[model samples]
Target: MSEFLTWLFATLFVLVVIAWYLTYTAARLDRLHVRLSGTLAALDARLVRRAEAALELANSGLLDGATALILAGAASESLESPAEHGEARETAETELSEALELALTEPVVTHVRDSGPLGQEQLAKLASACTRVQLARRFHNDAVTDVRRVRRKWTIRVFRLAGHTPMPHTIEFDDQMPATLGV
Candidate 1:
């Protein structure tokens, strides 16, 4: 009878340990999901800002307005949600490609025709702004990729069994670069 009691307690202890481990795993998954969510939000926001900057430049006649508007709209729409798969993400990628092509194409080259060249300082500033926008876009895309990759993991499925859905990371942009670099 004593042995039976010992075994019963052991069984209960084992069950409790299993429950605790599962709970811990679930919590960890939740934390990752949260991080992914925050990163995605930051990424989206940056993309929007970059797109806006491009649009502003284009509107000011430094770039083409049609291309800028298309790019802005594409970037804005891409933030609706994080793409679940390569195929899904490709759609936004294609739109971005189109905008980039338009922005860099013959129309801009032909429209901006003038005998006088831009001053060195003005050209440098424009180049710097363009580079910054490109970097921001890349940073945002990388964050989105990281989040999506985590969501696709098998462990995330286990977490789902415990009633956690991998939250899609949606990024938000900054109006201007804060002292800090993240979002």
Candidate 2:
């Protein structure tokens, strides 16, 4: 009787411990997903702000007509891109980056800076927006990496601890600052 009781208690203890561990893991995973969602939202907001800044610069009477037209088109496309951080979004943002690179030659930037207070302010806003986008992307990607790492654990997969949470992917876009801005 004593031996049987000992075996029963031991089994119950092991089961309880397993249950606790699984619960902890699920809770941790849930927190990670929430963090990821927040980071993604932040990235989206930064992208929009960057696009708006570029659009404002394009229409600021700083650049030439053709340059402004090209920049405006790219910024509009970025602003209107689908909310998903998918390939289309990436392409639109990359196009905007390219357009910005072409439009903001060092001499042109210097010309804008010398134009007036508003020109300097517009360039500063654009520069700040661009920098924020880069930072937001990095922070978002780091969160994604954390979630992916946790999701890939053998226990998480085998036990389905993540439940129905969809996997998160890193947002990759051409967020590099223009050379003129970097300096």
> Candidates' TM-scores?
0.53, 0.97
Error of 1 at 89 (Å): 9.1
**Model 2 segments more than 4 A misplaced:** none
Report the lDDT tens digits of candidate 1 across residue range 7-124. Answer: 9999999999978976776676566656656555554454444445444444554544566577556655544435442445546544543554555454454444331344222223
For each candidate, how many residue pairs have backbone atoms clashing (under 3 Å)? 12, 0
Clashes of 2: 0
Best by lDDT: 2
Residue 81 error, candidate 1, Å: 11
Q: What is the lDDT of residue 122 in candidate 1?
A: 29
- Candidate 1: count the clashes: 12
Best by TM-score: 2
Model 1: worst 10 consecutive residues (lDDT sum): 174-183
